[model samples]
Target: MSKRATIHRMVTPDHLCPWGVKAKDLLRRSGYRVDDRHLKTKEANEAYKRENGVDETPQIFIEGRHVGGYDALREHLGKGPDPKEGKTYQPIVAVFAVTGAMAVTTMLSTSTSATIADGWAWIRVGELCVAFSMCVLGILKLQNLQSYANGFVQYDLVARHWVPYAYVYAFVEAGGGVLMIADIATLVVAPVVLVISAIGAVSIVRAAYIERRDLNCACVGGGSDVPLGFVSLSENLIMIAMAVWMLGKGSV
Candidate 1:
């Protein structure tokens, strides 16, 4: 008898989250028995994150070993590929984060589909998800920047541009996230869609430069290893375009 391997995946309330489902399905197909532990709330999930320092959900562990998230698991199985790091490149921790985030954005931009009865539930829930994600990410980013402030602040970069830029981003994101709760507020969503997409574009560029030799992705607020290449670039670019098109049409 073949010894069945047991795989444990941490599943927070993000079951409806595309990435979570993808992780679950992929693990099942790999022939490992999946044990899912669902958390009660984001606070509970954060408690887990504190121990693991991994902010995202659907973490797959194989036989008690920390295999990784969806992308890492896929790579381990040789089914999906995230290439090895180049000589000068740091290890990448996000082989699938870019694509995953793109999928998330797609769901978030679907305001038209959200107008239907059941669809409203999905949209409203998705809005909450976005709001939660944004707030968590923004707070973490601000904290990270705080340490780096002295380096740039000495030159007045923060005073002249960084502070204003951050505020503009915060206002748009926080306000648009609130407005995104309903379809009638599509007007607010438009600018927000553009802003996030633009921010993604800049990040893609910066990512390329910062990781010229390839490196682990710190995009999702943790250390995840994934290959860096066209896949990453394409994902970000596609997401930017999607945001642009979605905002322009006032629907998806």
Candidate 2:
């Protein structure tokens, strides 16, 4: 016989508990027959919780044993802990990996003579990758400006002094990225990037080194759980390097 599970979840005309939906889906996928119970009103849900002595909904029972909420259900099923509950660098790594592949493909497609063996061509590819990454990350932040600003202000020195700076950071990264990719107005662009990235580097150093605080990096997006430390510091330092490289190459 297939295993059997029972779940109590909150469901109302205007709202549905997300965890409840997930728990039901998980049970079905794990080959269990589910007895779904929905509490249709806020008062009903609260009363149920109070009666059961549980703080949250989506409570599960399998074979007469209580399995708790979503996270607990996952643990009981041997699916490991929920990834969203912990830090992850997957977003940033994915952005860089995809953009890097795009840069190589673009360079090869545009020029028959372009090869990885060509030193200057490889340098150009690297620059394109960085510019593309910046633009993509900027778009992510812009998609949820308020969330980005909330996280950014926690660690950014400039944002700490003036809250509006958090709102403007996305535009600066995207604008500079566009200018960098276009290879126009290098004389102006290089200095601006240099200054901004230098300031960012210092801010990261103070927060991660001097003060020793663990923080979420707003570089990818505010929703991301990537830690603010080496990777975040590397981003600013790389921007500084790009600025210096452009200036030294006399791209103006």
Candidate 3:
């Protein structure tokens, strides 16, 4: 028999894709080089069937024998070699591991960027929020702080103004910053930060409460925040656990 025959393996980047890898390794053992350059797209798979007569991964041929699918390949190679143990949902396990890892990484990266190292860093980060806060605080700043009354709360609080409240927050933030760097009160701030992140993530589910349409985004490369959407919920579950894990370790 001529050894010129080839095996064509079609594989998507799915959990069983690793099974494709295993198939290739076995192919090499069986004296055939498997080609898989065009394996992921629907067009490619359809094209393969049009060109050849098969439409599946690990499509095998032994010296032009047309041995067929994975089971055929198994028989040609001989039995009693090894038995694959019953592994439940191997593909799902792989997918979950990958997706969970990615979401947690994203959340950690975002939280780290929003945080400032000390009072100095806090002042700098707060300055960036000034524009947004000021827009909320606008012309009202010109009037006396007492001039504005909250009809709902019925309490006269500090009138919202960009420059005025921005400065106010900046000054108070200095203390939180110092506390973080000094590690004097990390426990208190850590819980509050987690709570804030949770609220921020959940509030997006309600359209009326949406102040800004997108995330601050400078901290995360994806330029999106983890809201309460399905993807966002998954991200937050991982992140919330990470926060708890760090808290348990007491590392802040």
lDDT of each candidate versus the true structure: 0.50, 0.88, 0.42
**The 10-residue segment with the lowest total lDDT in model 2:** 109-118
Candidate 2 accuracy as TM-score: 0.83
Best-to-worst lDDT order: 2, 1, 3
Residue-wise lDDT of candidate 2 within 1-252, one digit each (tens)? 999999999999988999999999999999999999999999999999999999999899998899899999999999997666668888888988998998899888876674656898889999999888878988989989999998898888999999998877788888878888888777887888888788888989999889999898888877779988888899899889988998887653
- lDDT score for residue 17 of model 1: 51
If both were scored by lDDT, which would come out higher, candidate 1 or candidate 3? Answer: 1
Off by over 4 Å in 3: 1-5, 11-16, 33-37, 50-55, 80-252
Strongest candidate by TM-score: 2
Candidate 1 structure quality by residue, lDDT tens digits, 171-199:
45445544543444665565665665465
* Candidate 2 clashing pairs, residues 3+ apart or interchain: none
The deviation in Å at residue 134 for candidate 3 is 56
On the 0 to 100 scale, the lDDT of residue 109 in model 3 is: 55
